[model samples]
Target: GESVGLHLPTLSVQEGDNSIINCAYSNSASDYFIWYKQESGKGPQFIIDIRSNMDKRQGQRVTVLLNKTVKHLSLQIAATQPGDSAVYFCAEKGDAGNMLTFGGGTRLMVKP
Candidate 1:
């Protein structure tokens, strides 16, 4: 359910523009939400996180909005750049081991 494929695998944007990536999760009991950016061949890097108690959280040049009502989440990237090109994954904390269940990844393509 939370493992659905992304709407678009690759998003192309010009440098200095903003980009938005979307994801949907099925588990409502998920307490913690995290956004990660994975460059080619690299592991996912933590961008920001928010608890179920909060609806929105922000980080440097990034913002995450959580809508528990609809079981949806989104990531906003400011000032898109070629260096920012990577695959983004949204992960929800599982009930058992504090491990994360990752969503289908979205690849961002920033054109210079």
Candidate 2:
């Protein structure tokens, strides 16, 4: 059975610093990846995404990296801000159409 998980349960960063969150997935067949940010009491919001065909992709202040060799993925957030504090999750969608498998979220806390 394939699954996704985060390397850390929480990450704390100073405001304006960069943040990096890591994740690992056991599913080799997955082709699409998405990063999501969920504030308390809110649904996950799309942050950035990368495809298996790409090693890296950047959007606004966020970047997503995919490493197929190790089945790993990472999300990088630049210039962390208080508004960026949230629970972040990485999800993968494979050949199974729209079905997505999400990893347990890692809480991101930005300090002033």
Candidate 3:
């Protein structure tokens, strides 16, 4: 079994600043990783993803980076807004199958 965990339980950022959230995974064999954002009551929403073969991936306002050497993952958000305030999680899927192991989550607060 694999486990994922965030370095910080909470992250605070100003409305127009860039934010970085980090996570660590226990499984060195995990080949796929994803970042998700969950609002106050809704389910987790897909943000971005990166595979073990790739070091970095970019989305609209987000970037996902994978450091297989350290079994670490990170999500970077540019010009973060209040709408970005939510709980963020990193999930990993290994060769074992489709099941994804998710991290506890980091609460991101975008201040005005």
In the range 1-112, model 2's lDDT, one tens digit per residue, is 1244535488999999999999887689999999999999999998898989999999999889999999999999999999999999899888777898888878999999
Candidate 2's error at 102, in angstroms?
0.4
lDDT of 2 at 23: 86
List clashing residue pairs in candidate 2. Answer: none
Q: Please, what is the TM-score per model?
A: 0.89, 0.91, 0.92
Ranking by TM-score: 3, 2, 1
Q: Which regions of candidate 1 deviate over 4 angstroms?
A: 1-8
| Model 3, TM vs. native | 0.92
Angstrom error at residue 81, model 1: 1.3
lDDT of 2 at 32: 92
Candidate 1's C-alpha lDDT? 0.88
lDDT for predicted candidate 2 compared with the true structure:
0.89
lDDT tens per residue, model 3, 1-112: 2243435478999999999999888789999999999999899998888889999999999999898888899999999999999999899998897899888888999999
lDDT values, one for every candidate? 0.88, 0.89, 0.89
